[model samples]
Target: MINGVTQLEILDFSHNRISNDGAIALAKLISWHKSLQELKLCNNYIGSLGIEGISFALARSPALAHLDLRLNSYVGDEGGIFLCSALSQNTKLKSLFLAACGLGSKAGKFVGEMFKVNSTLLEMDLSNNDLTEESGELLNQGLIKNFKLQKLDLRMTNVSQAWEFAINEQLARNIANSTRNNINSNSQPNMKTIEES
Candidate 1:
């Protein structure tokens, strides 16, 4: 059904029953179409195997910058690792939502690794998952290395309130630093005035 159409920038198939096979097809389409910028397949039945293809496609996609796979419970820790490992190399994606994907402390380790290398991602949501104290600690450690992330939501998850608070504070600091950097970059000295002087 998605063959005739081409050059789609945004494709949202949220709240559907797209399972593993469907996700593979979608991954093929994502790879075939280079202009696709945003893909939302939240609330589906996609699992770890399905996510492997998607992760591979997105790792190489040049235009895809936003992705949402929330509520896909089958995409547990293994799938989460597949995504994080592949996306760590991605430089275009800025926003990601993976809430309620049954992610745990193991996935948290991969996420920490992802944050260490990924500099383009600005916003991410991993709320309502199985992230526990261990995961929270790992997440904190990862955020310490990341300076570009501006927003991260871990609400309704197993993460403690204290950890979540600390993460949010770190994100706020990143935003402030980014704003300061932009201002400094934009404020160019007037060479003409200096020359006149």
Candidate 2:
């Protein structure tokens, strides 16, 4: 099916019975069409090996933005770590949904670190997984440093309202602080100009 297609942009093969071979076949298409933007392969049998191929494709496609690999059966901590490695390099990606993909405790930490340098990502959905308090804490610290994240969904896990509130408050403060700095800088410059005049 992939052989005949030329200009495929958004391919959603989620909830299917595909395996590594299917994922590899799709991965090969990235080389042909670098303009592909979104790729969703949720609820499939794409395990670590398949994700490896997908990661290769993602590394090559600079324009690809949104990638949804939720509910992949073999997606565990190791798989999540592997996937995050590729996602860290994808600077143009705005939304990444890996909900219910079985990202365990260890993988969640790595995913949190992935957000450190990946500032272009706007929305991330890590709900319905096994994220613990430790993982949430890591993410909380990460959120404090990440200035670009707009929405983060960590529902159905070990995260509490308190943690969420703390993170959101920190984000709000960061924005307020930046605004104050900008205002101060502008006022100082204007005052100096007025004094000279």
Candidate 3:
């Protein structure tokens, strides 16, 4: 019951000192609002419990597209895993920001798994985490299968340069192939028209 605000689409509480209780309240609000598309909770003090609550709510929110949880240092690997599991069920989510959220290699693996099944996500930011080369390899395995992801930010993580280069190359190749297909499809009608004339 947020008064008459039933159609709220975007909720940004960045830089707020919202703790676990506040996160639970926000989660309830999100569950009630079916039109909410984006939620930003960056720099909050939400911990693993808070994240679990939020994840539960997000799992049911069909219209939420973007979720920003950056700089919530208390949400460690466990929280990351929980969020990833929830993301697997959320089909409308497109962008996720988990920068500096104390994520490590284990969480990275879960993220990779989520990507394999979650096809709607397009942008992801995992900067300033504790990821390692192993994590990068797991992520690469998922990226190879996921064609919808268009933007990825891994700055300040422990992922190696080689891995980054490979990911970039793959993305570029996908783009080039898609462009070529589009060009060929578009030219077919014109060629037919020219021949007919």
Candidate 1, residue 131: Cα displacement in angstroms equals 0.5
How do the candidates rank by TM-score, highest first? 1, 3, 2
List per-prediction Cα lDDT, in the order shown: 0.88, 0.78, 0.87
* Model 2 C-alpha lDDT per residue in residues 1-197, reported as the tens digit of each score: 76566676788888786888888887777545766788888888878888788777776665778888888858778778877787678677888888887787887788778878676787888899888888878888777777777678889868777887776776676567668878988777576678899
RMSD of model 1 against the true structure:
2.5
RMSD of each: 2.5, 5.2, 3.7
Ranking by lDDT: 1, 3, 2
Model 2 poorest ten-residue lDDT run: 27-36
Clash totals in order: 0, 0, 0
Which residue ranges in model 2 land beyond 4 Å of their true spot? 1-6, 170-197
Candidate 3 residue pairs in clash (backbone atoms < 3 Å): none
Cα-based lDDT at residue 124, candidate 1: 91
TM-score to native of every candidate shown = 0.91, 0.81, 0.87
- Per-residue lDDT tens digits of candidate 1, residues 1-197? 66667767899999889899889989888766767889999998999999999999888877888999999999999999999987788888999999999888889889978998899999999998887888887888899999999998888778888888888888999999999999998897888988999
